[model samples]
Target: GQTPLAAGIAFAQKYNGTGEVTVCYLGDGAVNQGAFHESLNLAALWKLPVIYVIENNEYAMGTHQSRSSAGYPLVKRADGYDMAGITANGNDIDDVREKMWDAVQLARTESLPSLVEVKTYRYRGHSMSDPGNYRTKEEIAERKKESEPISLFKERLYKEKALTEKEYEEIEKEAVMEAEDAIAFAESSPEPEVATVFEDIFAPEDHCPGRPDRGVSSSDRKLAMAVLTMREALNQALSEEMERDERVILMGEEVAEYQGAYKVSSGLLQKFGAKRVLDTPISESGFSGLGVGAAMQGLRPVVEFMTWSFSMVAYDQIVNNAGAIRYMSGGQYSIPIVFRGSSGAGLQVGATHSHTPENWYANVPALTVITPAFPDDAKGLLKSAIRSNNPVCFIENEKLYGFKDEVPEGELLTTIGKARIRREGSQVTLIANSASTHVALASALQLEADGISAEVIDLRTIKPLDIPAILGSVAKTNRVVIVEENKPFAGWGAQVAFEIQNRSFDDLDAPIERVTGLDVPQPYARVLEQAVMPSAERVTEAAKKTLS
Candidate 1:
């Protein structure tokens, strides 16, 4: 779940048969989630006078409905639930409204969930880079010609003389003018003032939900195990934060139902209740949009995408809406939202799943990116992320979640824009983040076997990277290697290299080097996946290259 579409459904169902109605509009792709099935089953069993509107655009990315789903016209899936279902032409507003009217009538009369599928085609590609190799441009153009909903409605309105030529011209002019006005307004809006920086991370203690467990200090006996592993420290952090802030709601698919796919959110729902610990209908776009909306409204939403790769479906909300809101709204609103999950290679998750989002999101201007390698850093960075007033992408390594570390107790927060010195040495600086940080430290040990005193710096934050640490080390050591489990071109390491070169070109003894994942996508085979990302051997090799 991206935000709380299921919560919305629950809200709608709560009002069913009371002369109130709830309608949810979702893309055809959302049906692929297991949560959708659960929601459908719940709606069916409860007979929650709800209308499920699926905006079936025929394709989920390049994977068409036929390939991604076994069912045709997905509405018919309601047959299993014994609910009434109908398909409508989404391009026709009249058709949609008419079917909606009928669906509502049926739900009201029978107190049952009604499925309405609206067939439409997105005029644009999924997210701008789609080459349309999956579907021919001619086919897309034909779909556009036949199914351009807004224009289709306009045509219908004009042919019936519901609007004369002059009126139609007036309508077109008005729409264009309004769109132009919005664009101008957005552009002319002043940039956020410096004071606005600390505005929206969380509601003030008085306004926010739950009083801080002013009592639970690092000494809480139950949290002693936190000293054993960074994973336990993270669990303790979640417990303390949740106990401290009632309004800090956790939502995502399986976060509640399955105790989080990674066990980070285990037993959260039992403690927080469904209101705060929501389980979403695996509609990433819908739910993530809902979280964006909820954050804008007031709630401190911690949205967990199982994997950053899955975030591909909701990139628009993350980049366009969340990143642009404070500036777009003239600092009148701040989005106190956090999106976290695993990234990079952990196993044979393959090309589709094993991706590091460092370059993808770090390039965005407004986002705060945090990727911690060790457990202590993870707990501290995650706490900082949760407390910060800006949107954050808190990335964790799939391999390191269970790694152990001695985390200092107390209300500890490792500052956002600072780097950690993992090992102090004068030979060379090995800068790394997330899973690569450990590899850097291990290689530092391995390099010690040779006579190189390697210095390792854990760059906790990617966006506001601890440049001073990097430059200071580079000035002293005069050589550096940036490592990560991501592709080389336009990757995070590239940006780091660019920044260092521009700022400290005079300090380097030799050219900076970066050890990163292969240029190709990670393969499904274990050996291939291992080969795709940087290893300790590769880090050591790259370090030696700089030394040589």
Candidate 2:
């Protein structure tokens, strides 16, 4: 299993030997992901000079650091990884720049990762929708007046004569204009071609197994043939890919020391050393965007989340930078990056950690979302994901971490967009993914017991769905139940349910039934949590209802 910090360490190790230093800026909240720990351990172990920039913005969404963390301060935590630490006022641009420059230089010279804590303040609420009532208004006012970064930067720029008042104002104006131009251009540009919805789902048709050097030595040995879990497979794939290409790296919280929240990067730290395996603070949006910027400079970074529920913190980066950059740049650049991790509800993880992000991201024409169900698929899919020229979301399942399945030692690689038939039958079609695919298969089993043959298909790649497979299945079965772990409203399941109803109106025996997570947010209580998501029994019933 891969922990969050291992994500950051991966990249640090990859870029360690190069002249450029890789920096991951994260917030106080992000330090909690399990991967964050293992990453630092690996970074220190290998001495792969990486800078861990912590933008300690005090609060982690609704919770304050005083409430969530017991700390002397974050930079000291870096010592646990045997790394050097620097703490400075985040609002002071001079201090921030000085500290960061020092950290970068130290990393380059030492080939070791260091943590730099910038005690900054976030002026806005976590996001546009945050009501922000947790902190007192007085506290907000005080922080705004005393520690505003931009304001402090302006004062320093003026006092130090870094630029004249008139020049500073002009620079601000240009920044505003540049931001506005990007928004305007995005709004006016044509979206990706619909037919190409099928494009980039896989490598250029030429990159598949037929090419001997598409990846690794064809003779890496088919060992035990099956002692690995999906997490192991994913870890191996990442390690192999990162080793094969100097440009490839990894970033996020716990990729190194903790091995991974699920232990996905168990042996990677030993294999690649520290500079490539880095740790980040708790800022999802910040580090994700940083990964995007690094990619722009020709580094391949794998940004892992302890789980995908945290991606809400970086929806903008995923959509704007990773997804839109190539197209927005008129195809002048490519995003050789992977934002990979677990997704969906499991182990009673409440509302905050249970989001199924497929539907939200599915709408973004510039990104690719991949959901794999088994070990072999996870490994093969992730390898392909890292190799991708575009930003790729390698979404995984916390619940499925231990799920085992046989994988080929050689050429059984699966591509994005392609759908797999988990099982086959004729009476009806059950289309689903992630957890739902498991439910659907169980439902199919129950259907068999009841004499209603059903076909089970896992739409492994959520975006660039295998629509043709879906259409053909529905055409033959005349009945459908789209299953998903998200709420029914606008979740990817609804998209399929509605699209199918419209496209195959006359070929139906019953309306499309959606077996999905309940509309309520996932609950924290074990019993209540189970009550929120779709289940084997519920799916089986839905399939039976369609037959009726």
Candidate 3:
């Protein structure tokens, strides 16, 4: 399940540890993949500290490079990317080392990525399964005789009087013995235990102080609260975190000079200066991967996508690299980065620009996904996300940015996995988050008029599900209705429905019903969009069905 393109991009993007250079070695065949082109484009554009070493052995598996790729030489392809390109004789150890060292120096000092194609040959077949049927035996024999790396180097050493025959033989024997010992150790190892199969998917939880059961303290309530828009609240949170920790930086399109597309980062550049609040090119893949690299180098980076829809460009880096880096590296690296932006259909923007991605990221185990309902949760949760030692996908709604609500003063950190019961009742449970939380609250008000007490739960965090709160509410109500703006197929509501049925099946009096967006591309027209999105009426109707 390894994507070399994504892995290489991730490595180059984040390999700035201790000002060291990252050299990514790949076969000539990888250049054909789209991710390879994308990665190179970003690296060259950003002047990233990376060296891409393409080992061109003349053939890609059974096909010759001439037949498979375009252009004269593979290194020449770097011209289109506006980066330095060079070639070296792979059989000449000194030549290869000099080229590689030059590439490393350029990347480290100039902040430029280089392409180095080593002219080489592989004597054997591509793999053990291959029968060496594609090339002539004479062609292979000629390569071994004239250009084999080891034999050519040994002869050169002897001609230079670098070592006597006996000394060379002793060195070869020691090398063989070391390799044999490594093989023996590997062969003696036992298979991993079956119980350990699920280990290391996510780092062990470093839980914050606040838990749902603890409830807000009386002294906590006495803290000052300000009525601020969701955008202002988020801005305040980012501002506070930046002030608290100088390592925290923000980067995205229009985040600096233009303030923000949604004005969520207004005044940040004025306060923190250009370096901390950077405005990047409109390349999501480039900037997002850069943030990953920056975070890997012991800095806290907050990367904002103009819209979650634009995040598709950087999906590979986000899901494959940021989500898996910690686990893949055996907890050696922590991608303490936040990828946040507006999500879900609300504006009349076409199908491509609208839609919620909470479920998409929530499906990832190593990521923490948060979709807060009100301004207070928005501020608190975003602060927590910034402080967290894990990759967090903070989903905000475009429709709710201007919506105003009260937020607590001073340092506030909402627990990542906790759900708050916005309104408590005992008849039926209404579950939702973000913009849809308001829908559930409205539905509860109508249900109360009809003499049905409905409890409303705002699932602040999507992953690390608050199963206890969900089960407790469903167990009391004995009936349930889930609401969400996302489509029904594999939606967050469906997962909530399954959780209720799995643990509170006996307590339920009726099957759970869900009110969600219609299974179709969101319409651009206002009337059609309204018809498709979940409304208070739809949720109330579903709640009544559960009651009936």
TM-score of each: 0.67, 0.65, 0.91
Q: Give lDDT for model 2.
A: 0.75
What does candidate 2's lDDT look like per residue over 351-434, in tens digits?
788777888788888678888877777887888777777778888988888887666564445566777777777878888887
lDDT scores in order = 0.75, 0.75, 0.84
- How would you encode candidate 3's per-residue C-alpha lDDT over 425-533 as one tens digit per residue? 9999998999999999999999999999999988888897899989988888998888899999998888888888888799999999989999999999999999999
User: What RMSD value applies to candidate 2?
Assistant: 9.4
Ranking by TM-score, best first?
A: 3, 1, 2
Q: How far is candidate 1 from the true structure (C-alpha RMSD, Å)?
A: 8.7
Candidate 2 lowest-lDDT run of ten: 210-219
Model 2, runs deviating above 4 Å: 1-206, 209-227
Q: Cα lDDT for residue 266, model 3?
A: 96
The segments of candidate 1 whose C-alpha lies over 4 angstroms from its true place after superposition are 1-226
Model 1 C-alpha lDDT per residue in residues 1-548, reported as the tens digit of each score: 32234433333344322455567677888887755665566567545666778889888887888888888869988898788889998888877889998998877676667888998887678887888778887887888787777778777878888877788788889999999999999999999798977664333322221113211112123433345455566666676777887657787778887888888887778887776776776667656765675676556678889888898887877887677777666677677778988777858887888888967888787888988877766776677677766788888778887788766667656567677777888989999988888889889998999889999888878887878878888888999999877888888788889889999999888888899888887888887777777888999998899889
Best by lDDT: 3
Question: Model 1: which ten-residue window has the lowest total lDDT?
Answer: 209-218
